[model samples]
Target: MLEAIYSHLARRAAMYLWMLVVFVAFGRYFTLTINVSDSLPGTVFLVQKGAKPGKGDLAAFRYNGGGPYERGSLFLKRVAGMSGATVTSHDVGYGYRDYFVDGEFVGRAKPLSKAGKPLKPGPVGLIPEGHYYMAAPNPDSLDSRYALVGWVRDSQIVGRGIRIF
Candidate 1:
């Protein structure tokens, strides 16, 4: 009976070790992220490490913000403008300005945040190389339209995300 128990325990240990090895090998190639915030349409996404970036593609990057979202936290957003694209900001009226990439409307920068804190619009002119403009359909999303999320650096990007739900 003792020998049988030992065999069972060894099998379980080997199974766990095999699973860990598999995860370590292909973990970076694929991952799953859950979005608690309703910033985008999906709550679950499958991240592809080597996926290409394009306009309207979902990109995952590290957050570099203050308060609530800590630095290095992963945040998923939409790719609005790519590198070398001409970005412009126009003060439409009130405390809002419309942002565009290559003259195509991307999103609007709100004058204030959900907390009512005054917010400033993002950058204009050409986007630098290895940088991208990200946004979210939710108006209250803290996207690239504000200084907090200014521009998403290429180094900060983790991968391209595909909505699973």
Candidate 2:
């Protein structure tokens, strides 16, 4: 009976140790994010911190904007254009521009922001190394198609986002 009790206690101690390591030692490796925008498809995501994002992957980045978008806000967006990929934009009339990556249509950008601010088109040309073009299905999204959210650098990539909803 004593041996059984000791074994149970050991198991409990081991479990607690593992929990402590996971929750405290490596807590920064994982994060939960809630998406409040139509920029992406899901409402919730589990971000794998330090994970390298690839083409077509959902990446989380710290947002740098103003006028409703808080600076340093975490944003989840799609990696539409990868490094070395060609990104081009052409006038689509009515002060709008369409963006393409590697000859594939990515999305379009409007001339004005939701707050009635004039918006400039995103950069056009080859995507530089350590940079990516982010996009969203919703055209109103302030992604890489506009100067406000221009090429997202690798340094800004927070993690790979796995959508939960």
Best by lDDT: 2
Candidate 1, residues 1-165: lDDT per residue as tens digits? 999998897879988888899998779698999999988998899888867678889999998877467999888999999989998998988989998889898888889877878887878888899899998988888888888888899988889999999
Q: Write the per-residue lDDT of candidate 2 for residues 5-96, one digit (tens) a residue.
A: 98998879988788888887556798989988887778989999999899999999987876468888898888999889999888989999
Off by over 4 Å in 2: 1-20
Per-residue lDDT value at 1 in model 2: 100
Q: TM-score of each candidate?
A: 0.87, 0.85
Extract clashing residue pairs from model 1.
none
| Candidate 2 C-alpha RMSD relative to the actual structure | 4.5
